[model samples]
Target: MKKTYDVIIIGSGGAGMIAAITARKQGKKVLLLEKLPTLGAKLKATGGGKCNLTNTLSSEDFMKSFGKNGRFMSTAINMLNKDDLREFFLSIGVQTDTKDGFRIFPVTHNSSTIIKALEAELNRLEVEILCDTKVERLLFDGESITGVQTQNEKFNSSNVIVATGGLGFPMLGANGDGYEFAKELGHKVTDLYPAMLPIYVKETWVANCTADTIAKAIIRVDLKKAKKLKAVGDLIFTSKGLRGPVILDFSREITPLLEQYEQVPLLINMVKGKNEDEVLQHIKKQTALNPDANVVEIVSTLLPTSVSKELCLIVGAILDKKFKDQSGQVRNDLVKIIVNTPFTVTESIGFKKAMITRGGVTLKEIDPNTMQSKLIKGLYFCGEVMDLDGPCGGYNLQWSFSSGNLAGHLL
Candidate 1:
């Protein structure tokens, strides 16, 4: 006799766990599989282990964050939104709160709190969890999903939800296995690209600014035949390259251009909301008021010492020369360096460092309302497995939980 479950969920990430819990709540037998030794391995590492669960953004603004692909998630999010997610977690005994009005976190501020709460709920509901169980492929009849094939055994289920994450943090078991399964079932898997990842640049000065942050830098990506893309937020300089909210948010657009071109140029406005004329005029006034101050000193008044010095080098301005002694051309050049700084992109640190992938199972094949595959009956996809990636600050997890919740309920 073969062991059969009412629902078989592949991968024990956020989406899979939620699906299992939901199905179990519906009085359906549920089996959750994880390739890694521990469940939610990658999820535990999110938000530096604080586990940013969801955002407080309005439904419309929240959906826009995922780009055009976000519209595909309308049904799922409408069914289980941020408010509903908060209520659900509270019901499971995980208290929640918010910082900065948008990012919501566990009241305990520890990711383990979330994992433990989910595990406890699954236990209470009698959901079966199989950690260290690698699901290699799906077992299906020609008409629908019949079960899943693991290394040791085949468990039967007409309802199978692939919540296996995309090819990010592979060491934590996010290996794009779900894409293969989708393709085998005749669903189109879109070209995958890394999003929310740092980019290696040709600017060597970025190393000197390592661990330093430009509080309000604006990043603009200029791609061939494509309109320039821009994002504004705090940007941190890393030893290897650039990393931070602004860069990560723009990474999805950068990845494809970097692949096609030898090097894509990234324009950075170090000072937000300041035009070239305004910045240059301000520098002139500052130089006149403090004639004895060196050019570097004058720049340091407006920018960090490290960044000011680097900008001086880029503009070929004399570091020790008094600001009053500098030519007007030098002042204009210095202002341009700060207002229109550019970095030549080499490549994005691939899937290993990516927070999420930009592409996966094409959205058209999955019903937005149910997260069920239109082609393969009873086969569903949710979370990063589908072609949806949102910006930083907890948008991605919202999609995972919402889509998983919708799928589970529909099943």
Candidate 2:
């Protein structure tokens, strides 16, 4: 059977929804296809359900968050800049607010609210959405994308937007199908691996002390070229090592080291921004002022009680056995431990457990301006489907919005 549409958008994610809405706004008949039973599966899971729709940082600061590919993302960011997003959300009735560090969330504080708002907007625009339907193949004419073949049937469209996300959580319906689709269309995909994942450490003490512990710490690492690097944020303990915003960010920087050294020794600073000499002097003075106090009690005042006790046992042996017994050297050593406790990042938690798939279809193969393919006309890529990945902020979601919006505008 023959099929027709002014625009066909694959992947009912944030990008897909935004693109569909944009295309519809352009007076184009639009349809969105999804393999999942519902739309916005990953969006529902983002920001722990609060859905950090987009960050509030300036375009310059926003561009810096992408790490290695910050400059390469200029096209998408320039197209759907932060102001565009704030306006879009307000238009869709999602009151947005920004917190510390420019992280933005809905005033309703619920991802469901964000999704519902988008769904309502899409509905109002009369965009057709198809869920639980998979696109079997892309029909291309070497010059442009003509249509797509789905499980139930075939369809034709003048414009096609491939906003399908990457392969992160299979349970959430991210099955690397987007990569397959891109490859099928003769796009070059980089080596796919999981990024923004938890770090696996070999330290038993970290595993035991950190288990179920809501740890807020900074990691200090000596980079190969960047010298000392530190990332500060809340960290979570896993059976193997650590996971959280800080750890995940730092882990990506040391992935190369992990691949080479099998384990990269990291310094976990439960207290960040404090220098070693300052910490030592503080500890020395505290110990001098309260020499008679029990060692655990004295140390507990300086650190988390449990962690302090464990550290006391590790460093206290150099001093006399008595609780309050400690020499200047030992006190200084204790401070050093606190200031720079080193741990190794062995390997990331692997792709299946990653928050978002790291690599995807190379951005060079796709036109940065319109998100259209350099090789395949009428085919556009957006969101995690491209090699573009960003830090833990709202940058990822913003990329989706911008890329989709770019495609929509181009359509």
Q: Model 1 reaches what TM-score against the true structure?
A: 0.97
Across 236-347, the per-residue lDDT of candidate 1 in tens digits comes to: 8987689888888889888988778868888888887588887877777888888888988888777788889999988778899976677788877888878888898898
lDDT score for candidate 1 against the true structure:
0.88
Query: Candidate 2's residue-wise lDDT over 104-136, tens digit each?
Result: 888877989988999999999999999999998
Clashing pairs in 1: none
lDDT of 2 at 222: 55
Give the TM-score of each candidate. 0.97, 0.90
Q: Residue 323 CA error for candidate 1 (Å)? A: 2.8
Model 1, runs deviating above 4 Å = none
Residue 210, candidate 1: C-alpha displacement in angstroms: 1.8
CA lDDT, candidate 1, residue 173: 88
Q: Evaluated with TM-score, which candidate comes out highest?
A: 1
